[model samples]
Target: SDIVTSVLDVSQPCEVNIAIYDISGRCAMERELEIDCRGEVEIELDTGKLSCGVYEVKVLSNAGGDKSRFVVVR
Candidate 1:
């Protein structure tokens, strides 16, 4: 089982867009998240339903955006 964890640093409450893309650039999963002023918040993505392969995680917010790559193997 693989899980995607996103750690965010926020100064105010806001909505965030979290998405996962497969190697072919297809969206595999996505979630709209909410965060408080808490300096760091962690969001978990359940990848149990996805096939084993390379994937990309993207996070979008008013502050900025970030992207990361990951791999799953069973």
Candidate 2:
């Protein structure tokens, strides 16, 4: 049971990409998210479907072209 959260700073009308990868270095889930320009946006991840191990979470913004990473444990 792990939760992964992240925030991105973007201008008005932007799209963001979120991805989750398992310990085997393969992508497990991915989503294309849209964010409104103003404040921080948060996303939650459910690790129930994943095994008990370390996983990688990646967040990317289309407007600012930024990439960030997070670690998830179950």
Candidate 3:
């Protein structure tokens, strides 16, 4: 699966940490990406092994961080 989101107000290039957590707060998937502060970032997630449920996504970088929730139907 793919997750696309935007990082706003970035002042410089940096390394961003993206992590997906299950409802129990356990880390299910994680990846590190280097971006040039271009405003939007698109990421690919391997969800084949993940169970159908609600999950949280955390995006962290030197500029800032954000959290959002998602659901997997299959």
Indicate the residue-level lDDT of 14 in model 1. 87
Model 2 residue 3 lDDT score: 61
1-74 per-residue lDDT for model 1 (tens digits): 46777788877788899999999999999899878666888888899999999999999988888899889898
Model 3 Cα lDDT, one tens digit per residue, 1-74: 54435344445778988898999999998888877756555566667778889999898987789888888885
RMSD value for candidate 3: 2.5
Residue 23 CA error for candidate 2 (Å)? 2.7
Question: What is the lDDT of every predicted structure here?
Answer: 0.87, 0.67, 0.76
Better of 1 and 2 by TM-score: 1
lDDT at residue 74 of model 1 (Cα atoms): 88
Q: What ranking of all candidate models by TM-score puts the best one first? A: 1, 3, 2
How well does model 3 score by local distance difference test? Answer: 0.76
Point out where model 3 deviates above 4 Å.
Answer: 1-11
Q: How many clashing pairs does model 1 include?
A: 0
lDDT of 2 at 49: 72
Worst 10 residues of 3 by lDDT: 1-10
Q: Considering only N, C-alpha and C atoms within 3 Å, which residue pairs clash in candidate 1?
A: none
2 or 3: which has the higher lDDT?
Answer: 3
After superposition, candidate 2 runs with Cα above 4 Å error: 64-74
Task: At residue 46, give the lDDT of candidate 1.
Answer: 91
Instruction: Please tell me which model should have the higher TM-score, number 2 or number 3.
Output: 3
Q: Where in model 1 is the C-alpha error above 4 Å? A: none
